[model samples]
Target chain A: MYLCISVLVVFFQMELLTLPALRRMAICGGTHGNEMTGVYLVQEMARRQKEEGDKAWPVPLVLVLSNPRAMQECRRYIETDLNRCFTSAILSFPITDSTPYEIRRAHELNALLGPKDSKEAVDVLCDLHNTTANMGVTLIAYSPNEWICLHIYKYLKGKMTLAPVRLFMVNIPKNEAYSLESVGKNGFSLEVGPQPHGVLRADIYNYMKEAIELSVEWIGLFNSGVMIEGGEVDAYVFHKSIDYPRDPESKQITAAVHPQLQDQDFCCLKSGDPVFLSFSGETVCYKEEEALYPFFINECAYYEKGIAFHLARKTTLKIPSVRVQRN
Target chain B: MYLCISVLVVFFQMELLTLPALRRMAICGGTHGNEMTGVYLVQEMARRQKEEGDKAWPVPLVLVLSNPRAMQECRRYIETDLNRCFTSAILSFPITDSTPYEIRRAHELNALLGPKDSKEAVDVLCDLHNTTANMGVTLIAYSPNEWICLHIYKYLKGKMTLAPVRLFMVNIPKNEAYSLESVGKNGFSLEVGPQPHGVLRADIYNYMKEAIELSVEWIGLFNSGVMIEGGEVDAYVFHKSIDYPRDPESKQITAAVHPQLQDQDFCCLKSGDPVFLSFSGETVCYKEEEALYPFFINECAYYEKGIAFHLARKTTLKIPSVRVQRN
Candidate 1:
């Protein structure tokens, strides 16, 4: 008689439980082919799902492995950067004659996860990435205006007991969007790194695995009406990109980042800090005069993209605590 | 009358001194242009020489920046691997029709450091190189038959207290020499590493500088009839190269090195040891049924060159004690 009452109560509540709920969740990986950690993690996760069967995540979760062809080549991308192909300017172009490989791939991806401009997109999307630069375990919000990403960042920060919590606000203009998360309603990318392409690093891979597991748990807890604590988050807002020193007549890069600042990423640099050293013994300084934090220092992938490093400024903000009313 | 008698005695003693000695020494760098530590150290040494005159070394020393044009571009080489261009078949080819840049450079270098097959070559030549592989402070003898190279190896081994020494006998049959050290009589390449190309790592640069200094000191001391000590040298002899596991029909690489064996360079691998793991969840073991040491494991530069790793075998050989007779 007790078990019969519990089943009857659950059946009645299924139609009524509406306010605090998780409808759908998606985790995408291998958007950029060279980042193997995400690709490997997703594969491992899929294998586990196959063996463990249907009752894993509380909500309907989707797994995406984007850019399979490029990953096969072991290069960043084949035709264009798949990560940068999500904008309408690229997507609206006819996919008929001579459409690039990444463009076609982007269209296919958007049909599943996007129409990023729509208000009724997926509940959350977490993209994973790895970089050749020394930025360690970074959580990036597309722009500072993203409230849900900030909420997720805050939750992850409070939960994680290892290493550190670094959140990036990549403030691209409101009209232009170029990332996998741009296609979703909420959440941000978690980038882990300093591992080279095609090389598997154990320390980095283990940390990312832990971060992903924590993210899934946080979403489940939220759906069960568990109130998540949120507060002041120390973040860095995007400033501008710094290109390596180049020659005037022949536009080739002619200098290297000064030996002192080689691996000094996310550290403050004042005005007149020697940045590059020329072949003929000339010192080039950071001429900005304001104290700015540098990131993505000497990224190998960015070498072909002509970016030496990027600058960001420190900022502080609060993620408002979320609540759902009892209907 | 007493001073004149002493001068006469010294002049006679100099003639009586009849031991074989090193006369001319040459130190070459930038043969592979992307190795910036050697290039920077050579430039710094040259600058110091300009400031301090020629009194630093006791012998006639020459510093050759082998590939200046390639170094300007911050690349490995211009036309061909300059290190590979010193062989007779290429060197003896006609320079008129369409000789490659490195081959022409090799001809010029031969006029200076070589005529390598002849007896009148530089008595000792030290080539400085750096790799993206995890080989730290390596002393490379072209083949094990080189007696003087072994003697020099023993001397450098006794000098360095920080790092363990690795000497590679890059086995090419008995003929067809392919290194810058192949031209000169009695020295080997001092390789420092795990540093990326075109990046100047201060720690690696300092270690190379110290290694170069000790090399020059060894040559100078040997010329003055020094009795150098020799003992058992732990050496790794080249076996063969191992390419990444690939699909036979598809011509694509299928796997990555196993997580446990990622950075296990210069370490022994026995039978049944998991070496490579496929994406489809299969482990490739070392099926050699014997123990072997792996070197240059997961080198970034060699990824494009299609080498997964190189195999070597460890051997203990005594470098015959070198003694120069005194008058």
Candidate 2:
């Protein structure tokens, strides 16, 4: 009888620590107006919602087209990048008549779906994006320990057949996270590409659409009392970014990504590998001491940010199996 | 004695009608600032001129960066597209303080190299450009009868081993022409692509470089009084452009270029071929009854211009062999 009582005590403790079921979610796009896949996907969802109502979704879903003005103009942003205006400090800034359009929009978005770090925040958020780099489909999250995002990444990787799926962890604190996806209790970004800005490709659009559908399916399964089994996932952790070789006086780029390195994202680079080809027909070699994987190679949008590419360290992350807790 | 006098008279008549040797040439780039191959090729040539002096060229050459402000911002244009601002009517407009930057720059370019229909204009002009379409290497001209340009196109087609070379005739009248290359006596644009705007690829840059070098070599040979042989050349004549499917209410694009059609520039399209894929996964087929070649498929910069792709008619032109005239 004493042994039976001890077993019951342990079961009670396990129930207290179980995660709650996610009741609300948000999907956003057009944070950068030039990225067309996201813009179209969000628009498509909104059209369906208007025609059929929200009964189609298992969870209450909010569809957001961030930076409407930028999307209308078909530009990246008006004053500053909207994706970078979501940090706690930027969001709390007082509104002024002279404030940029994006910052003001950020506040409106936070009020509607975020109020971040609070219990009222949506359970999941997925912001869609596109890149000119040949990185295939990538899931970007702020933390490696975000089990919800990691499990979704694993689910997407298993289900997606057209392209390789990968996870990229930015590893920043929640308060310091700058992207629109960071506003939810469990948030991440879905980035797919090899597409140019302001241009849409049918293959790329299909990849993004498939990912969203799979993510929603996973969410519905978990909510309906299905325990999702989790395992190890290979994730790329952000290391550093490198800029193109530039002229000293003019600060204009003096070279381009080497032919060998161009379009070769997520490939390991070691010392003495050719990285750039100078306009004068000379090759520039990588000089780093250690080998690292590079992604976002020659992304069109990041040219303004002075990033030719980003390097990361690949690591295996162990995620815990999860099931929605009963009230 | 009578036969000798007749031959002398015919020779004299031919000398009077012979075309003048090209003495001055201009090469311009950055008319669309985001086309990086042109911007870098012009920069590289300027650097060589600065380091090697005028002795590097057999003819007096002028290198121009057509849109400095746009290049600095890495945008297609700041206020208006510079490429579309070169019509005679636009160039003659009175300059006001509020005049668009591109127009002001156009006037500056006109005064420096053009004075369009005058003897003082550069003998030959080659404007460099890049497109996001998989167009290989293209020489765009206003008239198929322009012997100098046709011969250059033929020469480039024979010499360029990296990519296929073809001629695209805009077929517009000189006074109504709206491009920087129209400012010269015998002018055409060398366009190469499949590279994204604001990003450079080593292969694309090399193709542009090789084309430019071969053009210069052809000019030098003609100036040195060597006969250039010409033959039948195939050129695409502009027909019409088709816009993407759009929503009636919002006027936003509702479909994207189908995967089957994307990157298949210069391919023949017939009735009932897949052309676009709607956001909801429906395939839209081509409805034109006649077969035609399509080029500039899904160009990034043309989204705002409402052009999904351009249709053209391919025709063969017979070009004549010629040698430069000597005084």
Candidate 3:
């Protein structure tokens, strides 16, 4: 009942504000049910702005409170994660035939948030999420075209605690035809952090606001037929694996250590401890390089092959300038 | 500028009402940019409702205006269809890449739209689209789960001109990993009509709005832990191509047809169509009654012959339900 009522209110409000020249931005929060920071942050911003007489709102922003059931249950989702389920197959779900509850809310939000015409306000989609293990910000983007990402990156730079690193994480394999790669344009996954408690709430809210501002500016540039600065970034791959003693009780072997680096920072290990090849592949012998590879081990897990171990190390590698490759 | 400002205002405004208890629905319009009816209809309804001074808005609807640039150009999308580019490889554009104007626009729209999340408001994601040649009200669904589609079908019945033939009209191939299917327990596509003049806008709006109401009711029923009176529908096979046609023109056969049949309409094609006996077979042929016939065509255009054929004519054959064979 509340969901229906809220949709109507927003739908009507959008009607009042409809005009050809209107600029619009759609903001998404709580993509993962556990990533509640974005959800809370948007709501708090709205509440505070209203209390302040709406003077703080700079652009027409559509704040979406996504995945209510997941939020309530504090789970990723009842059946599937909403963030990962944005495809045509959604139409097959009987519940989705008429518009699933979440889809309906998103639609209502989109209408209210999108620009009046295709040529008007810039269309922007911003999904906020937190990570379970990774500690920095990563923007999983699509296009190698820089104009789009640069605009967003400019705005998101300072507002976020960790500088956003943009990269193409996956390609549309022949098998997974419906993956986000299917969108193949410039979709991105904004991974916030390693589960920052309350920090993400504020950061995401601020990031969204900045993104809205940038969108307005970007749209104005487009309307005037101006080319924005910047180019596409290439995909960055971070494959980090540790070799555990095939035995469970034995401690993991130490390999050459890489210095700690910030997000986007990349280090090249030209020479390290002799590469001790494991069943999986080549891994730096941890124990032999302990002095050079100062590290802290997290909990260990047993995989099919061996006992897997996780560790945090430091590096002083330079962040490489990358280019996005569009398929 | 107006769009940006309006978005800012709405963003904050929606945020004000985005408390934990509020119900939400996400409605996506123009998944295929040419399907302007749903987009326009949603906008019109919101406009009319607001203009009429209706103080009470029924539901919190998030209207997603997908692919504005494509819609403006009256094309599905440039470079690549935005609908088909949702995979991870194409998520974000680079900071220095140069591409077509439409591709960049797609990226911008994605950035603006972001991903779906958990909030009370975003319970559903209604993707509205139109057909190229078929003229019917058919739903493309992810699963045949009746719990969701049955109610949607009920609400959609008699509301629009398109015939709601069955509970579900679509199923993703096992190989197709769609986002919506990956998210909810149920999902579906609301394929409106082949309206040439975009006259179906009103009907689309009415169906969508009514569907929202039905979805809300469903959420209520489910949340109350009440067992709704509906049997689960079995998963169906989604065949993109039954046979890989050897001829160029003959290859025009498509799966998206307006099936002209009553309730359970299916097809039973015999031995004449070209069949790739093995997974790696690259031959085409017309199936004769009981013989595995072969026909001469192009030598090696494709790697493997397709097991399916394009439906050239709209024929309603009383075919038995083919068991869904997983890929």
Candidate 4:
């Protein structure tokens, strides 16, 4: 049963005629061990899939449990942050005395699900994450302008009607992408949060499972040549990563994000609005002239890295084509 | 500034004229290492106290960082649940071949806070804890029949106006008290929750710190012979620990607390109300007739010990004669 379907597939390009079909999809979880949202969701999906006797995705899914040891320890990572270890440059570095647990895990995962740059690599990837930041159902796009990525966002928005999907475009400096999704050909990371690192909120857990299963279903549908609608999604584009106010003397974060602005993530921030408040009772305000949105406020995992929040700008993403292939 | 004061501090027996002032109160935190509400709250309180320079407590306090090394690792405990490690029977077993890390710490703590049956021990103690259960500002009383326990309940209820206080009376067989506060003459354990272990929620942290500081102030006021109003507090008294529905063959818990009952802790439960739902699509209803209350639903840490929830009965506690001596 081979069928030719015309759809706008993202090949890292925005084109109406690109009709590439999803060959294989990989759903990676426990990329950072303490991110239990992905870890449990992946485990549940696998259990359910096995129990139901292989109602497998028409396109095979490579389930990667990136760091089992770290998950067991209930720490973010046993050594280095796994989420930050998946770069070609880092992978090329020799496994040395200083190489951490996650760095080695990344090399293994890349071997299993990658080399994502090769022709036989998985067609698409979806990495799951949870955060202490109140980022409700966030989709971070590594390939934002492409058709397949936009369609995935549109399908996710449609299925998760109650849990709105907010999109963030990933724009890092030249030669510095450090996410698991970056190792895949076409993919994005889904983050649901305000959940702490080592714990699973059942509500969030169920929702994330749904998000993951739906992605697999969507991939199956794509494999079956199902006509997907090219729809528009509102995304808060990445502008810059904002860090916590650090003390000059000790280099430690000395301020907390202002209470009012604490979880008002992705909301428009006006100039002169209070942002961070120091232990000494000094307030840091948003001094930018243009109104910007903020998210990832007080992410617990980011404490060591000093990221208080990320600044973003609201933008509309349009997807105008849809097609797939089946055989 | 020596002051003569005589407060009717309950000496285990509510003798109306037993005028023993609250000479010293011990505030213990991290009784369970992963309970970050106590850990962070205690840390914050200690930091604030040191920074503000001794605003000396009238009653004097001994602050115990109950399990510092365990807290450093962010686990419930290094070897055993520290809350369950304080019994005299266990502590008296001596340093043996099987002594775990927490057991040694318990011996050290007993030497510091106890000789539980001695006069030199702290007159009152309040241990702080956090749970994954959706319990908000709970007070667990070792001796619910005593006057001091009821008074503490009344005071906490009055103070935590936005967040109500729920009470659980600790009633175990003779010679078994599983908490640090049990060693003190008069005290209770305060638990704030639904916050995951090893993570800090700002809101919960602030509330817990407020609860801790208020407890200290109340102790100080008691020492100063402040006349407190005799009020009544509604408490949900502990009845039984409820386990989740388990599969008969595997003996594994196969059900989760029903959505309606998950976080509806301390709410009245009628006979036949849905309590748990099995993976096999069966609903386990609350089959008891007389109206009862439920709390401590779905505590994450309790999963290992097989507790799904707890049943309680609501009752009014009266704190009638509130008088103290002063000169």
* Number of the predicted model whose DockQ against the real structure is largest: 2
Residue-level lDDT of model 4, residues A116-181, one tens digit each, is 466766778789898877778888876456567677777888888546678888766313667888
Which prediction has more favorable DockQ, 1 or 3? 1
What TM-score does model 2 score on chain A? 0.93
List pairs with backbone clashes in candidate 4.
A2-A327, A6-A323, A7-A322, A7-A323, A8-A322, A10-A148, A266-A294, B6-B325, B266-B294
lDDT of 2 by residue, B1-327 (tens): 999989756654453224679988999989888898999999899989989898877777899999989988888999999888889999899999999999999999999988888888999999999898999999999987899998889989999999999899999999999999999999999889998888888999999999988898888888888767656799999999999999998898899999999999999999999999999989999998989999999998998899999999999987767787879
Ranking by DockQ: 2, 1, 4, 3
DockQ value for model 3: 0.01
Candidate 4 segments exceeding 4 Å error: A1-15, A51-58, A93-100, A173-176, A224-231, A243-257, A276-290, A325-327, B1-17, B51-56, B96-98, B173-175, B226-231, B245-255, B277-284, B325-327
Fnat for each predicted structure, in order: 0.19, 0.85, 0.00, 0.04
Candidate 1: which docking quality band?
A: incorrect
Q: Any residue pairs clashing in model 1, and if so which?
A: none
Output the better candidate (1/2) by DockQ: 2
Interface root mean square deviation for model 3, in Å?
28.3
Best by TM-score: 2
Local lDDT at B119 for model 3: 27
Over the true interface, candidate 2 deviates by an RMSD, in Å, of 0.8
| Number of colliding residue pairs in model 4 | 9
Model 3: per-residue lDDT, tens digit, B124-205? 4556665422224545555433234444554355343434433333444422433332122234566543232121223343
The window of 10 residues in a row where model 4 chain A has the poorest summed lDDT is A1-10
Interface RMSD, prediction 4: 3.7
Predicted structure 2: lDDT: 0.89
lDDT of 2 at A293: 90
